[model samples]
Target: MNALKINTFIGRQYDSNFPEVITDAVPITNPLAVDKAYNILEENEGDYLYGFVSLIYNDVVIFGEEQLTECLLDTWSTFSYLLESRYDGSKHHIIFLDNYPYINTTIQENGQYYEIQLDQYQCFLVPIEPFKKELKKEFFNFVEFCKNEKLWFSEESSYRGLLETYNEIKISK
Candidate 1:
């Protein structure tokens, strides 16, 4: 089994124009938890949803809190392309978030492993199959959650784009 693990949370920043009202992070354990988090954010009149995601390998934090400001759906949808890169013969994939406190994550394939770098500083190598397996599982789970909540129909363009890409990725896989 691969030692790589992915953890994520969803939270909101209310009153985003003036003073920000940051909500506590809600652990993304399942589809219901993500739905509940968004529902609560909507109820509280949040401007948007954002969150943190970490990649842990063998009990070490490869990517952590510095990346907390990413828009959850947008980041995940972009990150999903990493999986596609494996099959498309693309050597490297980078996920860059241009929001406040910018985040840049790069993943490059080397032989049977993928070397992942965060902000050009932190780096680690994870076996290709395991990394793909974990990422695909995490992404599909989020896609299922989006479908269950009808986000493609009710939410903004980001959600719609995510669903569209999800369908493409599913069909390609």
Candidate 2:
């Protein structure tokens, strides 16, 4: 079993040496605000930030539906758009928490359609889901892939509930 352990830090400013992966976590209270601040810092540092851009992006991993929600909300500032966007079920996904139950459930239930996995996995689907046809295709493709692979994960109901609620939140435009 490749169970992962998570290290969580809560604050505005994040400074860590945790190997930029899922086991190491640094959840900023307000990441957008911090990002803006970091942009300023980068401007002051001249070309130095560019050198660290990969590391910087890798360091901040978004896990769970809530984290994704916060991210989508911050970016789109609306629920309907987020749901519609996710309809295609395609986005770059990176799981940051080690042994997070909700994430494990997502992986267990919805891993086949795209490159959904533990850390820094790529998904082929695009983020544009407004109609039933698109969603049905993407969703069924994932389901068929899972069946063919015969892959399954251990599930926790509470975690599943949280994810379902998170999905509802996204569509609750």
CA lDDT of each prediction against the hidden true structure = 0.64, 0.28
Per-candidate TM-scores read 0.73, 0.22
Candidate with best TM-score: 1
lDDT of 2 by residue, 1-173 (tens): 21221221221122244445322222332343334434433443421111000111123332332332112111121212223435454443333222243243122113333233434442221122222233333333322332343323225212233235345644653
Q: Clashing pairs in model 2?
A: none
Assess the local accuracy of residue 127 in candidate 1 as a C-alpha lDDT between 0 and 100: 86
Query: What's the lDDT for residue 72 in model 2?
Result: 18
Model 2 TM-score on a 0 to 1 scale:
0.22
Q: lDDT of candidate 2?
A: 0.28
Model 1 misplacement above 4 A: 12-22, 30-36, 39-48, 85-102, 152-156
